[model samples]
Target chain A: MMDFINFYLVPGITLGAIYALGAVGVSMIFGILRFAHFAHGDLMTVGAYFGLSAVWLLGIPALAAIPIAVALTCLVALFADRAFYKPLRQLPTIYTVIASFGVALIFRSVVQLVWGTESQVYSVGFQKPIVLFDSLRIATRHIQIILATAAITLGLHWFLHHTQMGKTMRAVSDDPALASVAGLDPEKTIRWTWIIGAGLAAIAGVFVGLDTDVHTMMGWNLLLPMFAAALLGGIGKPLGAIAGGLIIGIAEEICTYPFFGESLISPSYKSAIAFVIMLLILIFRPRGLFKGRLL
Target chain B: MELSGILFYLISFLIMGGIYSVICLALNMQWGFGGLFNAGIAGFYAVGAYSAAIITSANTPNHVGGFDLPIVVGLVVAGTLSGIVGWAIARICVRLKADYLAMASIGIAEIIRLAVINEEWLTNGSLGVSRIPRPLEEFFTGRESEMVFFVFVWIIVAITFWVAHRLYKSPWGRVMRAIRDNEAAAESVGKDVQSFRTQSFVIGAIFMGVAGALSAHYFKFFSPDATEPLLITFLAWVMLIAGGSGNNKGAVAGALIIWAIWSMTEIITQQLPPDWATRSSYIRMLLIGLFLQFVLQRFRAGLFPEKAPKLNVKSHG
Candidate 1:
């Protein structure tokens, strides 16, 4: 039992952390923007590519490549905001959503055109496994993932709770017009939100690349899972996304172990697993697990 | 390259446009009237095409190929299957938030494609089913077969358009539009918003299914890859958005113009230098993407916006 638990549960948690990062970004963006940014998954893919490029160009350690990827991703997010999203601020949310889909398609095709529709592997140079106990072993890379996710989550918590910009962000998310009247530039706040959100997505993407292999369809494939996580956690809540991701990840992983004579659900269906959970949750409580508004 | 060639291409374009017009009209009913962003239309299209192909093609001795059913039966079955899938999706997804619904629908679409690709026993895996029988082959004979097929497809398109128009003007259409504009308000008036939207979605999907069957019969071949993102789903979105989201006439018009441009560009690009042509396809997609963004930004109302239907009642109180 412990062996089974360690093999499935621990890895699930780590994978969940990566999904949580992406989900938080999606949730925050949805909260503030009032439309789903469909291009976000592609943005994550862009970040992974940037990380891969950084590793190739600088010949730096994979650990060091992550921060560089994050910075580059943040820059791209800022640019995308200016070019694609900002102009559509006054339009209806539906139009913006469609626009985001266009942005995502453009981003995907560009990636495909550049990368040649092939899967890429980024060697992080960490091969050692840390044995946790008697029956279970974990990879050092997974440890890095867990630590990185924890640090980012804690850091975001601190930033949201203690910082002025964070407070303004919260205010903007809560009520944009009210925040605007209270001397916050809603545009600037939203831009910063995109930067932070996209930055987190980049970090998650790079980490996921390190954990597995990077592919052109990596982001596109993850879009549904991220959306599921975001929806599961309540659309606007960061903490909710984290918990939601963990639940989805662990549940899907554990589901791989079939009970009785039933066929085990394959890992390829991981995205579908997350979506099914999301559907059920939406049916029972459309507001989500945290009972928040449908941002 | 002669006058006859031009005429032939024009006729082909009209036929192709007629097929796409059916797709765009279906999408219009969903996105325009119902405000449902269905990114999974491609999946339904694939299902329809494959259903028709598998049904009409003669089954080989050593392989699963087709049932050799009648063409009309194949078309109906395709549409029915697609409608069933749409109904299932609507039952599951119509109650969710708009964005969540879109995500779910897209997921469903992806799942369908994956299943079709991976389910080797049923769909013959990636090799795809082919040799679908055409309707009216006996009457049309050899050279005139194409013309007869075009007429048959155009008749179906016309009937679909007529049904769509009638539905739009019906009381159910009013409820669908109201739901699209403001769901909360519609709910306040005691309407079963979910059911109405689901009906619209299912009906639209049936039309799309029929269109897919038509395409399969016309092409006489199909593969799982044929139902990929660009061809099935996004192209329909482009046609609908370009035409006018809320107007059937606009949707039909948009599909023709966009499809014509798309086909011509594809042909022209193919004739370019090999290296340049290969890269120009990417450019073509980029242009479409940019066009989508530009149109959405500049003219959300579309080339031919739907004029609000005149109301019969006026009150002074």
Candidate 2:
């Protein structure tokens, strides 16, 4: 049991936390902007790279660079929306989706140009794990990631339920027409959506970087799973995205566990788990688990 | 450049342009006619490349079937296999909204990629399938053989173009236009929108598979590198959009023009310092992405705007 907790469960939770943060952004964007936002993954890459830049330039710890990463990623998101998406608002949503796909390539290419294609670690070498409850072993970075995600989730909950802007965001997401008729500025709501979504993606990107070496494809690779989580939790449902993310993240990791004296699945095929799960959901629960808007 | 060098380059360009034209037309069938957004052209392309490679290559201990069959047989199997996969996916995802379908199709393509990479016994993994035979490769050698192959690819392109045009003039084409323009109205008129979309998806997939097979034959090899989304999927999308989505001629022209630009840009990028070699490819990709943004915003209908198909019979009121 301790072995299971140490090897499978802990890593799963850590991964789940990262997915939850990313999925929050994907879900929010899908709800508000009414597009898939393919570039959202690359936004995470941008955030992680920004954090790396801060660490390289300011000599700050990776954790200390979150503010810079979040801010820059938010800026990128807003600029992308303004330049690429806003014009296509009158066109079909697929136009924006196609544009977002292009934006994804653009962001990744820029990152590859600036940072080189090679993977880099946020911090040098590995840290020893701290023993918890005498039998459990956990890394300090994992604790930081999980706790930070929890804190963010709580903060998001408070903001969404209590704040004026948060409530307006929810209203806009639920129905842009009704919200606009209620005298809410659609543009303002969109700007806020990008800010929150990109900010969370940056943090998730940093967490991924903290856990493993940061590479250009890291965020792209994670994008599908984050999307799966968003769908699983239900689009437009922030809390549901959190739950969805945790389930998918944990499911992906735990699927490779050795349940019957042999691993249940080869690690090489582990990525397929999310795709399969997502396919099943699309077929049976097309509206999503939380019954989000069909669009 | 030397005349011979230029000639070789020209041959290579035309051959690739011909292959991309077939791909662009297949995309037109799906996106233009059916209004289905298939972002995973690479997936169908990979299936074609691998299946063709396995069926026609000389026997080898490295991988599965080197059946040494005729190239035509290989091409047929490639299309059949890919069409089946497309059918399965369409059955599952055809009802999705356009955005959802795009995401799902891309994911399906990724899964296909995963299978190609991991199923080493079938695909030979990252090393890819080799010693594949090109059609009429045995009859000629050197530049002459290439010229022959060039003719072969263009022949396929011609057939693809003809089929696309014929469909445009057909009654089925009219119904598809109705569905594309207004799905609810098509459904209300008793046209099975879902079934037509599936047929369009399968037809497009078969052609895409054939296009992939042509490429594999052109190179005399097959690998994951050739199936890169940037080169195959995204480039096709750019070509179709740039050429004109609904027009068959536009699809072909777009493939040629975009491909010419893609090929010629390499000469400029190759001039950078050796240290900037890797960075140059990224720059090229960035340029392409930016180009896509420009085209989407500025050129909505493309150079060849889609014209309404000529109706042969007068409808009685």
True-vs-predicted CA distance for residue B289, candidate 2, Å? 0.8
Scoring model 2 with DockQ, what do you get? 0.79
Candidate 1: pairs in clash: none
After superposition of all CA atoms, the RMSD between model 1 and the true structure is: 2.8
User: Residues B1-317, candidate 2, lDDT per residue (tens digit)?
Assistant: 99999999999999999999999999999998988998889999999989999999999888998899999999999999999989988888888787777777778888999998999999999999998888787788989989999999999999999999999779888888899999999999899998999999999999999999998888888888889988999999999999999899999999999999998888877887888877889999999999999999999899899998766778889
Question: Model 1 over residues A59-92: C-alpha lDDT tens digits?
Answer: 9866789889888889888887888778888866
Report the lDDT tens digits of candidate 1 across residue range B38-106: 878888888888888888888864236588889888889999999998998888778865776688778
The stretch of ten residues in a row with the least summed lDDT in candidate 1 chain A is A258-267
TM-score of every candidate relative to the true structure: 0.92, 0.98
lDDT (Cα atoms) of all candidates against the true structure: 0.83, 0.90
Q: Once superposed on the true structure, which residue ranges of model 2 sit more than 4 Å away at CA?
A: B313-317
lDDT of 2 at A260: 92
